[model samples]
Target: MAYLKERHLFPGGNTSKGFYSFYKYILSQEDGNRILCMKGSPGSGKSYFMKKIGAHFAAKGYTIEYHHCSSDNNSLDAVVIKELKLAILDGTAPHMVDPIHPGAVDEVLNMGEALDMDALFLNKKEIMEVQKKISKTFERAYRYFAAAKDIHDDWSSLNAESISTDKISTVTESLKEEIFHTQKSGYGADRHLFATAFTPNGIVTFAEDLVFGFENKFILNGGPGFGKTEIFKKIGSTAQRKGYFVEYMHDPLIPERIEHLLIPELSTCVLTTNEISQTSFTGKVYNIEDFCKADVIAANKEEVAYCSKIFYDLIEKGLSLITDAHTIHDELETFYISAMNFDVANDIFDKVVKKFEKFE
Candidate 1:
């Protein structure tokens, strides 16, 4: 059976305000593989091109990973074929990717070339103004995230004293030994399933998709600063050392914190979140809340609730700004769409299909 997995490269979070790209990991030539980098502006059919390629491979019973855009979940950022060690990604702004191996292992497919340059230049002034507005909106969103992070940090600090180091060590060691019986040999790949994208609706997580084929699943439930990430990292590190391909899903807001780990070779998945309980998965849950100082949490219940509200409110404000940015972005895309030559783009797409046919 084909094993398909989905994930996000960049999350909709504070880190996105800077350069936080996982494309280098995806385009790594460690295995001497090839990558098709699609270079184009918005509405140039880049996402559609990736979707078509993914569908073509899925039809042939190959496992494909669809990397969705953090800003617009409906759009795709990349598609991966694990068996072939190949990937096709959107190489544009915010996450611009350049070929490390150039024509050898990496090549560029300039979809923007099919656009009418003269027509685009005709609306250059309006396009520039819209671009500026888009940037400003994103800046405002990041400012909101920064404020939210401050409140979150304060809340986490309040509970930091309640975390038991002894319990963390015990849990980490036990989980490590159980997950990785013996260190095999080589290292493995690490990946993220979400980006810094928080929409007005709320946060998005593809945890279920990542664990779809796993037979053994463990959900670790605990409060903030409870060492859940430490446990996940311990197991993931051991798994990587033991020669298992590991996908480490990081918390969008906290990149250093691991949210989930998937070792496909063993069909094992370990997630650290209480939200998994809401899912259909009937996995064994190991509650780490036992190690937390319940008395302290109970004492500061009101303070905790207040801080949580502040964090959520700031995040909501950020999401509102992002929504506005997307609105302007949509208008920006209209100009590009009008300037593009779909007929030529279709011909190029057909050629790309023929190239993939050779893979069969």
Candidate 2:
């Protein structure tokens, strides 16, 4: 009914590695929960199927999270209804639910069965050709991303070498006093996923929406590779020790590095800024530049400019290649869509929705 929805990525393509996955983190808050894993072809209505289910719950005032496909943001990798401990996902490539399909916790829903096999068989050769093209297109995209990553590393190293560990300690300690204030006896849960992704549309982040609901929101500003993650990690570690759950929204470029942190237990969130966010800070602002050597950054102005230009150019090329991949994907979808029997597919979707009604 209301505009109450959140978007995230389960599997994201990036510069560091070709395909990165955080699908396991979807609905990870609770195990043994009901999971409806959809098995289908490209245009088998998997995304459309999930959309209807998500809308149904949202109309009832249920806040849902759509785990969008990084390659094609319009499609979903998963839909999480945390309160119901239920999720319906496109259990397909890149984010395949596991080698066993549904695994032990998930219940399989096969939309592939609704396909008109005779029709698909007629286009078998065309389908294979398009699928092969899609694979090659993505490979080209990853090559460009790989090239960009090298330059980015060189750029980051320029600032990283001059970081002040002592200053980092000082600010983080202040954060502990200012944010945590007290400690708990036990440890807290830590969940990980990407808050931002490098898609065909370029770098996309839902940081504002992800953190908007928090009453206490903070933005961390700093130079590249300085101490953004270090600060967030410090805050997250401190939150965990103080019995608070932390959601570490990692960087798409460097999956290991956190770009943002969420501490819902404290109704607080602290995220890095710049191209990643546009939200006005409602809480404290920690500038990582304050923790790094100013003169070192000053000296590397030329290097920063040089590396930045090359890195961004290479990244743009990669985005174009990814766009090619998306185009190829559209062609592949057409084959399946042509063979799809929506009347039968909708019947299957209706039955699946019925099974999930108890949760509503």
Candidate 3:
């Protein structure tokens, strides 16, 4: 059986503002049917376990949303089966989530329960030392990121002044018409996630896959501070007010700002090209720079170049620090991996899948 697959990031971690999370979006009984919070140390097979369960249901034609980790794109932070209204998430620190309706709507799946106590006990000191390094390394990376954001903001202020506010609506008029041609009035909902992340390895994005097969697309391409995200917000809010569900994929570096919008009901999407999103969009490609006076940007090119160099350099420094930190984290994981029994974990994985097999 063939099924639909989607990917996103919940808590996007970066240097600009440290870590920004959308974990509260994990709705339980009132929102969804069930939520499974997996408790375990790093490299304890939580991601793999979740994948196994997702695969089982997807094979039966269920639509699955795989939430990838910001720091590690290869790893998953959560697995959501929309058809079942069920989700499984990594319940660890940084973005820790506890059950709002334990037992009733939420359940804890603890992998540590099957750990070899003697093995972990013998390696406790090593784990402590590695943990210290990871924390400190992240701190250093954040500093670099903060500096880069400050510089980036300064550079963007120059371009922001030249934008034609009135033309914004004109540019988006076609998109507005396309999205609301057959609209219903009432209240709708919105969910926030990330389509890209500033990972230790580098910028990892799933933009192409997320927007794949959509009938219509409105894409923006230009430099920062050109009102790209604001365009997304305007269309997104209007869509919501019209009783349409919208999935907002935010900027990983600036999590508060959205970079893309997906309205599944309409089979339409809107987005902007950015440093983080490596997606090459097809459809109406609107150049955001068109709204800005070319002469003004040309005059400020030197300063823009200066700021751009430093901003990206600082970003590179941050990524380097994060990479180093993860290298140390890998060492820390070795201890946990050595102490865990794969056979027991696999058994637990099977039981978790079995519970969902009976779901309507």
Q: TM-score for every candidate vs. truth?
A: 0.91, 0.92, 0.95
lDDT of 2 at 160: 88
RMSD in Å for all candidates? 2.6, 2.7, 2.1
Model 3 RMSD vs true structure: 2.1
The parts of candidate 1 lying over 4 Å away from their true place are: 5-19, 192-197, 274-281
Off by over 4 Å in 2: 1-11, 29-32, 99-104, 183-185, 274-282
- By summed lDDT, which 10 consecutive residues of candidate 3 come out lowest? 1-10
Among residues 3 or more apart in sequence or in different chains, the pairs in candidate 3 whose N, CA or C atoms overlap within 3 Å are none
Instruction: Give the per-residue lDDT digits (tens) of candidate 2, residues 1-360.
Output: 122355555445454688887767777625636788788899999998888888887777676888878888777888877567788877777667642334556778889888998999998899999989988888888888788778877888998877888988888888777677556678988888876777767677776677766777677776567767777877888788888778888877667778778887677778777433233555788778777888988999899899988977887888888888898899899889988889998899788777777655
Cα deviation in Å at residue 48, candidate 1? Answer: 1.1
TM-score of 2: 0.92
Clashing pairs in 1: 8-193, 10-195, 11-195, 11-196, 11-197, 12-195, 12-196, 12-197, 13-196
Q: How do the residues 268-288 of candidate 3 rate in per-residue lDDT, one tens digit apiece?
A: 889888755656788888887
- What TM-score, to 2 decimals, does candidate 1 have? 0.91
State the weakest 10-residue window (summed lDDT) of model 2: 1-10
